[model samples]
Target: MLHLLTPDEIFPSLPEVDLERLQRRGVRGLVLDLDNTLVAYGGREAAEPVLVWLREARAAGMRLCILSNGRPRRVRLTAERLGLPWVESYTKPRRRGFRAAARLLGTRPHETAVLGDQIFTDVLGGHRAGFVTVLVNPVSRRELPHTRVVRAIERLVFALLLRRGRIDREAWRLRTS
Candidate 1:
C-alpha cells in the first residue's frame, strides 16, 4: 500500500533536518518540489530556510535537483540561479520526471529521495518510480487553484489518518526503498 506520511515524519522538523541524518538514511541525492514545499507559488526566489538546507545538503556530499509540474520559467530561473540541475514541466506521478532527475543525480531511484508538498502526486509518483517519498507541509497557502483542490483532498485523507492513528508525531518516517 502507498504510505501516508506527514512532513515531520518525512523530513524531521524543518529546523532539525540535517544532511548527516539524510546521509544515514542513504539518501545521497534529492529531487525537491518547488512552490509550496520550497516556497510559495509567487515566491520569486528560494527562501533563507531553503538556501540553508541546500548548502547543508551539498556540504554533506548530497546532490540536489529541482523537479516540479510547474513551468520552465520558474524551474529554469531557480535552477539556473542556484546552479543546480532541474527538470521543468516535469510531470509527477510519471516516471519520466523521476527518471530524468535520477539520471542527473547519477543515482538509482532507490538511493534518491523525492521531497514534495502533495501526496497524490508527489508521494504517489515518487513511490511509483521507486524513490523514497517524503511529504512536507506546504510553505504557504497561496498555491495555484488546482493545487488548492488537491490540498483539500489531502486534508480529508489526513483527517482519516489522524482518526485511525496512522500519523505518528514522534517517529515521522516512511520508506519504500
Candidate 2:
C-alpha cells in the first residue's frame, strides 16, 4: 500500500526534472499539478523559467496539461498564463483525473508522466493510472492546514526511507540546480 504511494522519481523542483531524459524515456505527455508543483500556492502565474521550460518541452513534442484540484477559475487563470490546457477541481488520487489528463494530452497513460508535490494525491493517482510519477518538493512551506498534516506524514515516510537507504540524503535536500 505504501509502495503504491512512492514516486518513481523525486526532484527538488520542476526545473530539476530532466525533460530531455523523460523524452528519451518515451514520455510523450505531461500531466502537471498546479500549486506547489509549478509554482507556490496562490501564485497567479508560472514563473518565467517554468514558462520557458514548458515551451521547450512542447517544442520537443511533449504534450502538456495542468490537472489540479483548485477551482476552475484559479486553474483557468494559471493555464491561460502558461498557455496550457487544464482540468480543474480534478479530485486527484482518483483515476478519473489522471485519465482525463491523459485524454487531454492525446496519449495513453503509460506514455504520460505526472508531476506534483504530494504523494497521496499526485503520486498515488499517477501510479494507479499507470503513468510515470515524479514527486517534487513543494515550492513554499505555506500550505493549507490539511496539507500541513499530510506534509508531516510525508516527512515521516521520508525519514523511514532514509533509514532503510531506499533513498539518498540528497532526496530530502532542495536542489537549486
Q: Count the backbone clashes (under 3 Å) in each candidate.
A: 1, 0
Off by over 4 Å in 1: 4-8, 12-16, 169-177
RMSD of 2: 2.0
Please provide, for model 1 over 1-177, each residue's C-alpha lDDT reduced to its tens digit, 9 standing for 90 to 100: 525333324553232455576677788888888877766776867778777878878878888898988888877887788778898645677878988999989998888888887887778778888887777666776877887887777777766666667675333233211
Each model's TM-score, in the order given? 0.85, 0.92
Tens digits of lDDT, candidate 2, 3-84: 6776778887787788988877779999999999887898886777777878788888899999999878989988988889
User: Which ranges of candidate 2 are over 4 A from the true structure?
Assistant: 174-177
Question: Candidate 1, after superposition: displacement of residue 175 in Å?
Answer: 18
